[model samples]
Target chain A: MPGEDIVLRTEALQKSFGSLEVARSVSIELPRGARHALIGPNGAGKTTLINLITGQIRPDSGKIFLEGRDVTQMDVAGRVRHGVTRTFQINELFPNLTPLEAVTLAVCEREDLAGQFWRPLTAQKAAIDEAFDILTQLQLADVATRPTRTLSYGQKRLMEIALALATRPKVLLLDEPAAGVPKDESAMLFSVIAALPADMSVLFIEHDMSLVFKFSSQIVVLVGGGVLLQAEPDVVRRDPRVREVYLGQAGYV
Target chain B: MTTVSQAATDPHSWLRGQSRWSYFEIAFWVIALLPFYFFPTYLTLASQIAITALFAISVDLVLGYAGIITLGHAMFFGLGAYAAGLITKAGWGEPLTGLVFAGAFAALIGFLTSFIIVRVRHLALIMITLGLGFLTLELANAMSWLTGGADGLRGVDVWPIFGWFEFDLWGYTAYSYSLIVLFLGVVAARRIVHSAFGLSLRGVRENLTRMPAIGSPYRFHLQKIYTISAALAGVAGALLTQTTETVSLETLSFQRSADIVVMLILGGTGRLYGGIIGAIIFMVARDQLSGMNPQYWYFWIGLLLMAVILVMPNGILGGLSRLAGRRS
Candidate 1:
């Protein structure tokens, strides 16, 4: 059983592809409601780790725990139903559906109404209201009726977040949420992230140091397929090893 | 603030302003009623179009909405035909009962087969579906005593629908029965496509990778839709068998499967009415063109299909909808 205080915990997670070790005995713990940032240089297995946690790929020999329950054996959908959800590094919104339709699906799924077929989706007034409420919170109400494909890059990124948030997830995993957005729009995106409910735990992998420094309460640095250092944001910022491994390469003092 | 309040009260406002009845749908119903008045002698042809449209709609559910390309959907249709035919031959000839039995049997087969079919994707899915069709065809052919061999199951006698309306020579009963079934099927399919479950199936089609992340088990939803499609296809088969009073090997042929796919593509995909419009256009064209020259009818059909494809790559209805500035 996972401890009550820790919402998500990985124990000695390891993965390898042929001769390459992408993750080696990596262990991390996320406390309840913690805002954590995972930062690493390129090729440091950040994506691979996110994949393992979300059950996209299995870890060779390790355990994953969610809310004190072992979920290492759970599939992606099972993990999601258990209140874990994630956004793609690249946008994965349904191009044919409007943002309202897409987010409504997420909301309906969370409400256990995804199997309903006999009634019109519009009849789910409460789900629609909840979905609209989420869109409003994400500042996407104006464009909710437009097809997702027509949205600008930054809007799509936020739409992806809206999709994730609509699941009512206890732990949200964001994989490079601001990867392709313009720098100017990314600030708006981060501000929205900063405004998420306080009880929701978040683990995000990002390349932007400014957003990382401003948003994360705690920072975990990954290097060479293993955890290099995990500490409070300020300590991680000032760590010599962290500076040598990441800040040095990215020209951040 | 008023917009939000109006949206809350008018529940349908959330559907992106799409209405249930479009001019096209209204026109379709009007056209469906035409055979009863103008050409009573051509009721058989109208009934055939209705049944074929039902089959095409089944294909659309999987191919258009769920994105599972199949080349052997006729297996379910044929199974349903055989089941209904056998039931009538056994002296229990209630039309509705036979339809239910046939549909359920076909759904059972679909449920069993989907375990393997849902595991593969792309070319492998097509091959497996095609193989299943052939396998069932061979089984039917081998069971000569039961299936009547290549000559086909014969002497199927259907009881009058509800013991009131008799199957008649002028094809009035067949046409009305088929039209009613087609109407019910269309309503059900439309309801499904507009539901949350339907949306998830589209989600699976749009991105298999992201469906599970959003709490939809990919294989489960595929299996569910596949089974439902098979059941509906079975209903179409049952309708055909009951109307014609015969079940033939042609019903199981790969060509039948391919024709339905072509009809679906000809109409449009992903849209509920695409298959219905496609079947009407394809069958009507085939009927008229084939009457002109039975020997080279395929040549004319081929030319017409080529023209349709070249002019509207998305499909006939898809193109028309675009021209009308309607959101698909």
Candidate 2:
């Protein structure tokens, strides 16, 4: 994998909020097809890093590179077009609109058909087809016609991922994709996320250790606004620091 | 799961399912046509209703679809009124071109102000819109040479509709002209709301922040909708000037902006027909009530507003849906 191109990279990103440093010289990389986890405690600034990566907020000093191209100055929409996108921990969806309508809009956005106003939505058959395909992939096709608000919490979570897929991002960021979902649906949700197109690298944040270790091939543990460790799951599991500070396993290992 | 792929291959049927013409929609339009036959004497009021309905629809686009409420929407309306009046006074007397000029002029101003509007939200947005409205009113009053000031634009001479059918004292030509324009505006608006762009406009209203994640610029969408709404509102104003043969300061007043909002709330927003229905009821109520008891008309209107709000929090269409046991 040495010659493989990295899909996403961050260079010594520095950010602080008043007296507290949220991101301190934090740097990480995801190679093509990487499924990486971002794990941290309550104040580890995991969400902050996600916000910075997705260009929702700017960092004080740092650079973000997507597919070897610098994208630090890019806005959220610019970053999304450049193949980097994210799903929220809290569902951000069009409550009154059906999933089919929402997903079709997402496809239209990618194809620049959003300005097609003279014709009806039915005329965008190709975009709708593509949207349904994305919905089917996320197992959201069954509830596609229902208003997004009426969907089960699990289905709603999947809908978020379905929308992210419509962007066709090269790197997908998941901020607790399984947060608040029922246990049974949570596992299914993770599986669907885990099985996203192989070429699209995933960077996810999770507080659920079991889900993290079970799904993420690699883990980046953030502590005190910095990367404490970035390694394979086994290495992270065996590390005394992670075991003590996060796992809280004083004697098991 | 089997149904999933089938829908993936066929979205046309799914789209058709949502847009099937209801009996109510057809009947509504058919009823709108009846004023031509039955309301011969009240054609003046009918024409006014049509013009105000068009204005309400324009405001509906911003508040209902884009979720950007404004207290200064009358600025566009007034500006359009003035444009048509000024153009007619300047010898362009062609009605259709006057309408187009008015719309474009207001749209230009709308586009410029949208940059300021879309950048803020909630209370701040409302204040900015109110400020814009006041500024427009003062501008109209200060520039009395062109606008005719508080006395109104005196020499707005509108040409015959379609180079035929001159406006008359009985209000036949004016009613027909305004109604036709309003109908065309409705058709155009319905097409827009059912388009991919229109759905995205709803998306902007529902979740502004989420749009960027899908590579859609939220601010750009808001600005576009605002400009469009402004343009339509301007056309409605042009209709007023063309029909009445004058432009008044009241066209740009704070009251005009507030009244449209009230009308939309009464009819329901988002649904394209809400503004139309609301305008009819509000205008008709004003006429009938003022004729009977001019000074207390406001009291009755206030009462009606309270009752409507209390009984139907979502307005007429929304309340109707609820009564039918359907979630709108």
Candidate 3:
């Protein structure tokens, strides 16, 4: 913890959509190089919390900080510029673009490649190179040139993560990374997460108990839009409140 | 220094090193010089081709690049022609000034009209554009004093290009003038389509949500594409007025709007050359079929369109491109 910078920390975060309170006074911290997990019931506001962190939706009240810098008011893209990248719950890959093209475009956005339009897509060697590297790391090299629409659902999901990785963020947020993916492909994702850059911090929301236990070093539980418990994966799994709120006494917790 | 990452590690590195412009430039030159050596027997037909080709290309920019489906694009072209005709008849005299004014005027109308149009999508957008075109043409018909009513404007003098070329009513000057303007329009459209701004438009067309997720304001880019497309449509209109030396309220008719859509669809939507081919084939079919039987030509045209739609939903070039893609 001495060298860790607490890459992302949220203080008393509160969010409500109209009359629905989805996140309530949630306080959370992600260490400099920590792999943190947010676990909760189906409607525990985990997605809302991730959305607030990435500025996809504004918090009704509370603050989000990245690398000790306040990013409470930044828009989604602005947060991306500040090194926060997020993978959506549903795959958002460009359906017609190849995985390589998708990653290349993400690199273009990261490097401000919009102005290089007249220069030809081929001229941005460095950005393209970096994109390729990111795609390769995500195990997308095999389907690099295949249009995303042609890829299997698992590959499309992987491509979505590759796109987020292409931004080269200091803090990465994954929303249900293992949801809807094949078991084999889901395991591959864990391997990819384990292989990310040492300094990068990842905060993930997942419902898959196996994925959560395998990848998370720390876990925070949210029940009914509020923090239910925060502890190591094993401890949180055993917590009675987590059982009562998420497991409901005798079910999948 | 660029490090060569292994293909096993990253297969797309090859794409990172290739340029998309060199290929585009080569294709552009081939198309631009094509008409010069292949002028048909009648010069009037050639001139008509040039004008219609420019119009088609203009429509393609909005349809293909911006992903805007407009059936009323002729509104800008028709406005440009009528504005130029009226201003020149009022002693503006110079074709260049008339043309510039025409584009400016049409662009202004386009800007105002688009604010109401761009907020809608698909069928609603098409209907709004169609309605806007109809209303403009109707208004033009109602104001006969300036627009010559349903009779059409006549005797509008267009001075020669650069004061040296007198526009002859015959094929000679009209053909050459249209050829030059069409070439210029193609060059400009190509530059715009290949430009960085255009790339952003492509991005928006590909995925609207992804654009803002990457920090782009999609609405601003959409507006820019709309304005530029209108300006292109305006130039095509101005060229038509210059060649014909007359403007009819019919220029803005719903039929003309429908014709543009047919032309784009027949050629291809997003592919640049689709417009040119669509226009040429459409006009030639109209001319030949009408010669055979003027009264029944619409029947053949309708049948031909139906066939094209049923056989190739992407139009000719679009279908061919997909075929080539599959083979590749």
On DockQ, the leading prediction is 2
Report how closely model 2 matches the true complex, as a DockQ value: 0.65
Error of 1 at B220 (Å): 2.2
TM-score of chain B of 1: 0.94
Residue A33 in model 3: lDDT: 71
Q: After superposition, how far is residue A150 of candidate 2 from its true place, in Å?
A: 0.6
RMSD of each: 2.9, 2.7, 4.3
Candidate 1 structure quality by residue, lDDT tens digits, B218-250: 687788889999999999999999999999998
Runs of candidate 1 exceeding 4 Å displacement: A1-4, A247-253, B1-12, B16-19, B326-328
- What are the DockQ scores of the candidates, in order? 0.54, 0.65, 0.34
Off by over 4 Å in 3: A2-20, A55-75, A115-118, A245-253, B1-41, B90-101, B108-118, B131-135, B138-149, B326-328
Output DockQ, candidate 3. Answer: 0.34
TM agreement with the true structure for every prediction: 0.95, 0.96, 0.85
Order of candidate numbers by TM-score, starting with the best: 2, 1, 3
- For candidate 1, lDDT tens digit of each residue in A1-253? 2225899999999999988899989999988788899999988888889999999999999999998899999999899999889999988879888778888888877777877878788788888888888888988887777778998888899998999998889999999999988898888888898899988999999898988999998888888689888888999988888888764574421
Docking class for candidate 1? medium
Estimate, for each residue in B1-328, the C-alpha lDDT of model 3 and write its tens digit.
2323444454434553332345644685576455556654557777787788888887888788778888888899898888888888888768777878988898888888878766888899888888888888888889888788989999788887889988874567777777778877777776666544566667677887676566555566677667777777887888888888888877888788889888889888877778888888898898889999989998987898889878889899878777876886
Clash counts per candidate, in order, are 1, 0, 0
DockQ for candidate 1, C-alpha atoms = 0.54
